[model samples]
Target: MSADDKYPEESGRRRFVKGVVGGATLAGLGVAGTVSVQSLTSASGIGGGPVEAMTIDRTGGPAPYGMPQVPIEIDDEGYIRGVWPEVDTEEVQGVEVEIAREELGGLQYSQEWFQYCGHQSYEGLDPNFDSDNYFKSDSAPGYDWQADVKDEGDRFHIDDFDDYEEWGNDVGNSGVGKPATATWRSEDTDNVIPVVIIRSSRMEEAAQESEWLDASTDEGVFAFVNKCTHFCCVPGYKRTGESARYNAEDRVYCQCHQSVYDPFNIVSTLYIALPRPQD
Candidate 1:
């Protein structure tokens, strides 16, 4: 049985969040990396209750964003392979090769970055499914997002490469500028992952300097799991309207709690809860 099947009340994602903030001690959870609870609580002041909170203290100079390290393995070919089975190995390898050889900038929008895996469509998903029902809010934005997907005869064929160049390369477009997204399915697991590729103008500049490239900058290509770390919500890319945030660039926004995660530096901060209030 899958981890989710064994733990019906809480999926792996929810359990992880709970261990961090729901008054559970972190000593034996076997979480991937080390993160100091004191650092997170001292930085964000997200104390009290069983929920994990993050606030950008605009008035408090710079809010201390602690980097949460995600363990990643690189092959001899410079491909990024995650320890988790949900990761798409072939896709990530191709991307890493392109980036290492500096051929990523020449890639067309119709390339592998925009290919959708044919496991299932969001429309066919049950909103009440365990994966979708974990959010605290009743209104799951994914439902509306699925509805907004233009029908292309086949539900699995969600991506339209015809306008990809115009939407991804054109900076003036109001929608997510310079980014393309697609969905991928893992053969080893039931996880349906969403991937986004961002083409930044800074890539050329960074390439010329011979310095380590920043994933958020123009000189890099980044791909990450679409699941929101906060509540396991599948964040929509470039979504607009009252329910969505205006993401003009390559960013992931969770509609449930309006949690914004930068795919480029997602590991930069770890959010942990302080000691639980005395009973």
Candidate 2:
């Protein structure tokens, strides 16, 4: 695909934050209105308000919305990388602030999507944070196959998921998808951004039907920030036997609260984003 088929060039972008958001939620701030009020005089950060983001479908649980999808690409050598949005500046409430946003898959995809849950203040969310932008294997993984295949700090390669069509474990039926536990835009920082990458024939089929899926995913590989929206807990895809009890055997399930998400579905969700901590 040409550069035009991908995100806009870096020379001009109405964007700000270009990295995965961090962990932790604003303990007392759940309502967007309350967060907006504090945004006025908090003198603590930049960019906070209601925003729409693409996410996997949240089927059951206390989560207000589904986890945000992370756009990805496979390089010439087959390494997978998360697509970071562009960085630009805009004024909010009369204050000049940097923001990361871009038009993709028929909507405005931005850093704001990952801003809630204290992600706004993470070092990785800094628009200027430098990284090669590849998704790296986590030191520890929920899947035994992943632990046996990849070591800590290894970049994911599309070739690694060769048997995704029939891959299965003790948790669920075979052939749902293959998953990788990883981190994005989190090198050299205390804040580790958890990410989940999955490859499946289902995704390839979906991309053929949806423009958004076609643009954001490649080789049946797609990803999302691994934290649960309800409690910021890490979730797994077809990783545990307990998921069967909740009818989530073929989906992403959060053990923290039994929240279930359908990876086969991607939808839009609206939530208040927290401003990045200004220091």
Candidate 3:
């Protein structure tokens, strides 16, 4: 058959392949099937009788459906490396991220999903991320954690750190209980996005004993890519025998060159390569 005869349009073929392969990939990784934005039942259908005087199965009042909830955890390295109740992708529409630092009292980062709700014009956005800048580890060396993230689809996106300089914030805010607002200017396009921040400390608590909406064993499946932004190296965390927890006295060990970072302020270039400068 001719190419045009077999495929009437380019999108016709691409759409078919995307649909078939997407499900296969998700299933192989044990990811729950994606949910749609459709509603299950109507509120008006409840609370009425069948016949003139029959209460039949309609003997009900106002009721709500409680969807099953799942628990997940975040590790010391600041990763949510665990399974979770599949969330509605529409939820990608609105996400609240809370990142707390220093005994859950310092740096409260919050970004309501409402900002990115409607369609946006991404013209001139930098998809290449070449113009993006990294906040040197020395600037915020008080804590050290890594969050490595990757995805097959556009499920994840990055923001340039330069855009948020006015707010006095930076990335690497994914540590245990340190919440910092993340700003990324799309390299491929001209768009800036914001997300709520929550770090790994809460995960430790959730792991010890599950409670509240944030506690879940499966949530632990995810982990943050905490490598040094410059050399792409991993930093060590404070062990039990360390000087003290989350204090400058405690340091984040860099294996590449025995470099130690104070976990209470910004990082320092005592021995290893220097970290990128913060805005």
Q: Best-fitting candidate, measured by TM-score? A: 2
lDDT pick, better of 2 and 3: 2
Tens-digit lDDT track of model 3 for 1-279: 243231123223545644544564455233111111111121221111111110001011110111011122444543332221222222212422121111111211111111111101222111112432211122222222212332111221123111222322232232333322222332343343322222333444544553332322223221221332212344443422322222312334334322244322211111111111111
Candidate 1's displacement at residue 106, Å, is 24
Please give the distance, in angstroms, between residue 186's alpha carbon in candidate 1 and its true position after superposition: 0.8
Summarize candidate 1's per-residue lDDT along 1-279 as a digit string, tens digits.
Answer: 344321223223445544444432233222212223432333321111122211111111011221111122334534332222121222231221111011212321111111112212232121122221111111122333333553311112213222333443222243332343433322223444444434333333444553223322222333344544434455544553422222322444555534455443332222332221111
**lDDT at 182, model 2:** 96
TM-score for predicted model 3 compared with the true structure: 0.20
Per-prediction TM-score to the true structure, in the order listed = 0.35, 0.87, 0.20
| Model 2 residue 12 CA deviation in Å | 54
Span of ten consecutive residues with least summed lDDT in model 3 = 54-63
Arranged by TM-score, best first: 2, 1, 3
Q: What lDDT is reached at residue 141 by model 2?
A: 79
Task: Identify the candidate with maximal lDDT.
Answer: 2
